[model samples]
Target: MKVVAIGGGTGLSNLLRGLKKEVGNRIEDLSAIVTVADSGGSTGRLRKAYHIPAPGDIRNCLVALSESEEIIQRLFQYRFKGGELDGHSFGNLFLVSLMDITGSFISAINVASQILRTKGEIIPATTEDIHLWAEFSNGEVVEGEENITEYGKTSKAKIVRVWIEPPDAKPPIDAIAKVQSADLIIFGPGSLYTSIVPNMLIEDIKEAVEFSNAVKVFVVNAMTQPGETDSYTAYDHIEAFLRTTNLSKIDITILNTKMPSDVVLRRYIEQGQEPVIPDVAKIARKGITVYAEDLIGESQDFIRHDPDRLTEVILRAVSHALS
Candidate 1:
């Protein structure tokens, strides 16, 4: 099977970890399309100083699919406790230095993938240092990914639209061809606006997805994001996605049907969050096939996708589609 996953952050990495095991050698091709609109944490700091593509999310995905030794993986994920590099991860710095030495961000990623012995290829949505600008429903325009959370508080301020500046940004050639030849294309279980939608804003990216023969699948979030997608239902999630891109429909929608344990739910509610109670029947009416499974996992403060279970759900959906 050939699969291409779009979006970035932990969502993509988690999915890759699960998929890598199942498909192993049967997987003829696998690719990840990562978002580069990040301007937060170590990635933002690195981008500002070096003018290189943000490597935080890319590094995470690379490590997830890596066949490197356990020690090497641990080394990449290591965080400095104090001093000048406090809170900075070693993988981020390694990528920065690699980009500097190679003189190209793509070249740096290629080298890292080899070092990690990654199972699949990874590509940025675009090589350009593009900025994400989102318009709230109240007519307020928030300029950065980190800033969107603050404005996402109001129900009246739903994301009206999002677009990358210098709108003609082109995708890396490998990225376009992957989508064109993919057997399946999966969107996020990540932040809707910040991670997933930003990828669609790239002109060539939208064009590739819209025109491709690949079967598009969407993995809906289990919980409503505190600021960006609070109180959003499953239907609301799909609608928000279609509103952002040129793609007209999704082939399969993967959702979590079981609610989390009450203890976990309470922890999230304390932080102003709740599960996205999807109306599966309503989603079916929208002309998209709905696949529900127990996808939630236990986490300290936040609910996360149980990567193995979620991967099973995705594979089942694809098998059903192919059959």
Candidate 2:
């Protein structure tokens, strides 16, 4: 099976871990198309100084697929304490050093992948250092993914459109070809604007997804995000996807069925967020098949997708499609 997962951050990494465990050798191919719009934490600092595409998400994906020792994985994820490099992550520094030595980000990633012995391929949506620009419904334009989340609500910025500057930037040819040849394409369980939608803003990447022969699926978030996807339902999530990209209906939409404990729910509410109480039947009525499962991975104050359960649901959907 050739599976191509798209998005950035922990969501995609966690999903990859599950897929790796479940498919074993039967999965002949796996690839990730990660968003490079990150501008926070170690990645943000590195981007400011080196002018390289953010490596945080890409690094995470690499480690997730690594067939390496736990110690090596820990080394990549470790963060130094209380120094000039205090805020920088070990993986971020490793990637920058590799790029500096190799003189190219793509080549650096290739080296890193070999060191980790990752089972799958990973590529950026674009090799260029591009920023994400969002035009809100109120006619105000937000320039960066990090900035969009801080805009106040009365601002009424509806994310009217998103585009990459130097709009002619092309995605890595390997990334585009992977999408075109995918048996199944998956998007999101991550931040709507920052992760999934940012990748779609790259014209070439979006075009490849539109032209792919694979069945596309969106793993909807279990909770609505504050500032970006506030008050959004399951269907609203799908609608936002269509509004952002040129693609039409997604073949399958996965929704989390198990409600989180009240303690966890309260903590989320304190943060101005809430579980996405989706009208599942109504979502199905919209023509996209909906699959409900126990997708929540336990966390201290929040809930996330259980990598195993989430992967099971996704593989089942893709398997059904293939059949």
Each model's C-alpha lDDT?
Answer: 0.86, 0.85
Q: List the residue pairs that clash in candidate 1.
A: none
Model 1 lDDT tens row, 39-79: 88878887788776778889999999999999999988998
- Which of the numbered candidates is closest to the native, going by highest lDDT? 1
Give the 10-residue window scoring lowest on summed lDDT in candidate 1.
Answer: 148-157
lDDT per residue as tens, model 2, 1-323: 88899999888998888877745555778899999888888898899898889899999999999999999999999998996989788998999999999998899899999999998888998888988777787888887777777662446456767777767877899998899889889998888888888888888888888888898899989988877888888888888888887676688999987789888988888887788876788888888888988789777655889888888888888889789
Q: How well does each candidate superpose onto the true structure, as a TM-score?
A: 0.96, 0.95
